[model samples]
Target: GAGVSQSPSNKVTEKGKDVELRCDPISGHTALYWYRQSLGQGLEFLIYFQGNSAPDKSGLPSDRFSAERTGGSVSTLTIQRTQQEDSAVYLCASSNGQLTNEKLFFGSGTQLSVL
Candidate 1:
């Protein structure tokens, strides 16, 4: 894909179910990130992966939320035991690096709805 690609544009699950969202970054990009935006709210950083360095998971709201990047290319975010409060649009973005002036290419995002 020429830009970031996220799978399952929308998902609806029960409160206790699990959901997984996938993202494929642009080719040769080394920085991947996950962010969530609730209705009418700003985006919240979830996790960040840069090259081989350890993933920064500090922004995850709880243990129920987790993410992993494989081969520095594709990444997946998993939300376990979903709650209504977890419903949001999960966005993925990629950049060449963390340079202050670099711009990120974002995916359309997966909108998750927990009932």
Candidate 2:
């Protein structure tokens, strides 16, 4: 892909359902990250994966949130048993291998609204 790609772009679900948001990172990029941004809020780092080194899941808000990256490329973020507080934009980004200070290219994101 020319840039990171995110599926659905928008999702609205009832408060107890589960939703899966997909992300396709730029080719050859070695680091991929998932973030969440609520309405009028800053980006919240959910997880970071780099060539499988024990995925950094520190930022996951709760047990209901999970993510996985396959082949060091595309990734998916799944929110289970969604709640009203979970309504926000699920964003994904990728970089050309990590070294900190490297810019991350973001996707349009899947807007999930839990009503």
Candidate 3:
């Protein structure tokens, strides 16, 4: 893809079910990040992967939330045992540089609905 791509634009699941969201970054980009956005809320950083460096998982809310970037191209975010509060838009972004000043290209995101 020419830019960040996210799969399953929308997802609805039961409260106890799990969900996986996929992200594919643009070619040659090395930095990837996952974020969550609730209704009328700002984006909340979830995780970040940069080059061969260890992923920064400091933003994950709990152990149930996890993400992995494979081969520096694709990434997946998994939410285990979802709760109603977990319903939100999962966004993925990628950048060419690891520095905070770099510009990021974001995906359309997957809207998760837990009932």
lDDT against true structure, model 3: 0.89
Model 3 residue 34 distance off true place after TM-score fit, in angstroms:
0.5
Off by over 4 Å in 1: none
**Which is the winner by lDDT between candidate 1 and candidate 2?**
1
Candidate 3, superposed: residue stretches over 4 Å from native: 52-54, 100-102
- Writing each residue's lDDT as its tens digit, candidate 3 over 4-107 gives 99999999999999899999988888999888899999999988889634468999999999888778788989999999999999999898976853588899
In model 3, pairs of residues that clash are: none
Cα lDDT of model 1 by residue, 52-90, tens digit: 354588999999998888898988899999999999999
After aligning candidate 2 to the native by TM-score, how far in Å is the CA of 107 from where it should be?
0.6
RMSD of each: 1.3, 1.2, 1.3
- The alpha-carbon lDDT assigned to residue 45 of candidate 3 equals 92
Candidate-wise lDDT, in order: 0.90, 0.88, 0.89
Model 2: residue 98 alpha-carbon error in angstroms: 1.3
**How far does residue 80 in candidate 2 sit from its true spot (Å)?**
0.7
TM-score of 3: 0.94
Q: How many clashes does the backbone of model 1 have?
A: 0
Q: Cα lDDT of model 1 overall?
A: 0.90
